[model samples]
Target: MNNRIKKIENNVQDKNSAAWKKLCDYIDRVAEDGSEEFSPANELGYELFSQIYTLPETISKLKKVKKVSLYGSKLKRIPPEIGQMESLENFVPYTSYSLHWFPYEITECKNLKDSTVSTRALYGNYKNRMSFPDLSQNPVRYSGETVNCSVCRKKMTYDETNQLWISLWVGTDVLPLLANICSEHCKNALPKPPENYIQKAHKGSSTLPQPPDENESFELQIKEYEREQNTINNP
Candidate 1:
């Protein structure tokens, strides 16, 4: 495992999905376990997550692909268009420690069957300790905002009290954060995932993080929300 990590850390390609794709290909052929998917190894180095955070456009282009897997890529997010892959079936984003959730667009893949994610890093992950990324820092305008699912995009603002954080915990290892959840069905579908892992309760976008989910236990919990002020009095 140490050697594998070293290989991944040392072999980071240009920080794009294409570069990650090469690593993905190599893992499929060489992974000791023979699983087509493998986790990110030490081959990568500092700031790996920063390099590939913006490559969703490239990942979405592989639409014809059925089975997909990415490990140790240090990805911070998955493109909402990832749901555009109508042919998708199996997913293996195991060991992508940096990812925390998946965009609601993932629900669009009506045919998707299997998934292997890093549940710990997910926003609503078990025990919920991973740091949540600050939404305030994300640019309000982007190419995918207009073209992707309108509900999933975080383009509109509401009375801050009414605003809610939409999150999902799809995999057990790698939980790539989704853009947001803007609908009731999105919320309901999550309370009980159709397959794989068990469902845990969590707070919704409308709730305060300090209190967490006053209702139930969530499989993955978004422990914190980005606040305008660092402290709660300002929060």
Candidate 2:
């Protein structure tokens, strides 16, 4: 079997990086002007854009954006603050292979109805059976000042919270979400995962069981992705 699924590090935005400043500036413009769409790649240019490994917590300021297009981003994770983008509707992070999971808080975007994602790269995606990060071993971190319970929004600390993975419907896709809860009652309050998923919120570990993957359906897709990565790296 392949190696145990490792936890992908959350590369926090470097405040001193040019990419951060550019992205912050773009967000400022969007917040003041209000827009139906936001695409940082086009705004930051390829040079600075490639440096973006994750978005800022300031993403919550985009209160009026109806769509977010992060096609081909290098992001490893999205901040939980994205849940505050109440007007968000279409989320397009289609080719962002490094983005393995989302914050459970994303479900709070009541208007999000459509999304484009790289299913094979996502943790717990039915197409790949990618292993989720073993939260039991890896420490949980939050983008906010304090970790809050994903269910009831109760304030919590590292010593008081339990972090787990849950595959839930976000827009039209069922994506793996990281949930930080203060108590078992909050965990029990989590919405059930859809059919074909793990069926419950679970602390991810290598020993954690999962449904068998249909390798035949995704072999070519995986190979193609590898080829593209090879070309980008070798060229």
Candidate 3:
């Protein structure tokens, strides 16, 4: 298995474990109380690091939660069902090193306001660049295998879909989100990415514009500083 999948598998939690029970309890509490702030990481005695993947279907039940924190968890992906949380306002997943991207369905949360993500760990992050998975141009349906469109959740065949990647700020932190769409129409329906990011979705490849070289950037800064010092002395 590749390193990414390996990391995910390593963090998978057993459903019957004490940690899972604690997570369940927390979820129930949030659901019952309709609490505005939910931070599973802060729960006492709950070792969340071992639970790499979240039960997205279970999380869909947190309809009344406004803020969700998964800081430092080992999550690999967010469930597309997160869009169903109509009341969700803020999200914090800072330092989740294994999470690479988000599902397009998160856009369904109209009230979402802020997000905090670990940008360095994301696919195609500006600071420590990483490559994104190449999406298939012609998605085909395999007998007995089904994949839903990331945007509409409609059943889609491999031949009928298109895949693309985009970076957007769901709350405060910018996240690289992936879209598996049924048609060009769904692709076009995606919202614009956050300011200072790529303006549109593009295929993941080396052809994408490269970020500025760190060494070159540092040299330019030094040059500017030297020019400023020279001007000060002459004046």
Candidate 4:
């Protein structure tokens, strides 16, 4: 039996995916002066990335993006600074199955609402109930050193960064999309996170972790599942 599990055999390779190209094209047109709205659109949706190196700078300036969406992006981590966008209202990354957790800074966005996330893409998201990664140990120096995740300047403060944990109660909605958020503040601020999803702050489910070692672990787990399936078939 094939070891592949529902791998999307579509023509949309990461770099060549239609969504990736469109998002890149949009990003490229931005003036980068921080004065423009970072490509204002009535409805901005879908993001596909082959790597995480290009987001921080553009995200820092995308203060005007009110509606956004993404799916199965190569991004391993999202910055907490994303909460700074006060104008943000609708966020839709429904299929970005790779993003695992969020930053403490997303609570800053007082106006956030409406998200479209693929619940199956989160950590403990019922469908993929893989055990959540142990964050009992806070990360140190993920920014400027790693590409999947870029820590905010606020998280760079010596000693202060480690003690910081922000959780927000956004609201109550059964939005599987809500599962994508990783921060406490972002969750608390939500009008309501999806009700049917796995418990909040539980590392429900989603893509693999950011570090290479973690990816190796993910590969191992995948193999374990394959062996189990093989046993069932043999029986």
TM-scores of the candidates are 0.49, 0.87, 0.72, 0.48
lDDT tens string, model 2, 74-171? Answer: 88888888999999999999999888889999999999999999998877777768787788778667555578888888887777889989999999
Per residue, candidate 3 scores C-alpha lDDT tens digits across 1-235 of 0112112232244767667677778778888888777787787333564564664356778899888888888776776768888889988888887787777778788999888888778765656556665454322222234557877688866566676888877676667776778877778888887654667886665446545434545777899999999999998
> Once model 4 is optimally superposed onto the true structure by TM-score, how far is the C-alpha of residue 215 displaced, in angstroms?
27
lDDT of every predicted structure (CA atoms): 0.45, 0.85, 0.69, 0.43
How many angstroms is residue 182 displaced in model 1 relative to the true structure, after the best TM-score fit? 7.7
Who wins the TM-score comparison?
A: 2
**Candidate 2 overall lDDT versus native:** 0.85
Better structure of 2 and 3 per TM-score: 2
Candidate 4 segments exceeding 4 Å error: 1-48, 126-128, 137-140, 144-160, 163-235
Candidate 4: count of backbone clashes, pairs at least 3 residues apart or interchain: 47
| Tens-place lDDT digits, model 1, residues 52-167 | 54333444545556667566566655656667666777777677775555555676776677787766555544344333333433222334224332354444432221122344
Q: By TM-score, is 1 or 4 better?
A: 1
Note the clash tally of each candidate: 42, 0, 10, 47
lDDT of predicted model 1: 0.45
| lDDT for 129 (candidate 2) | 82
lDDT of 4 by residue, 115-205 (tens): 6666554443434433344333433233343222123232233333222222234322122221223244534544433343333333321
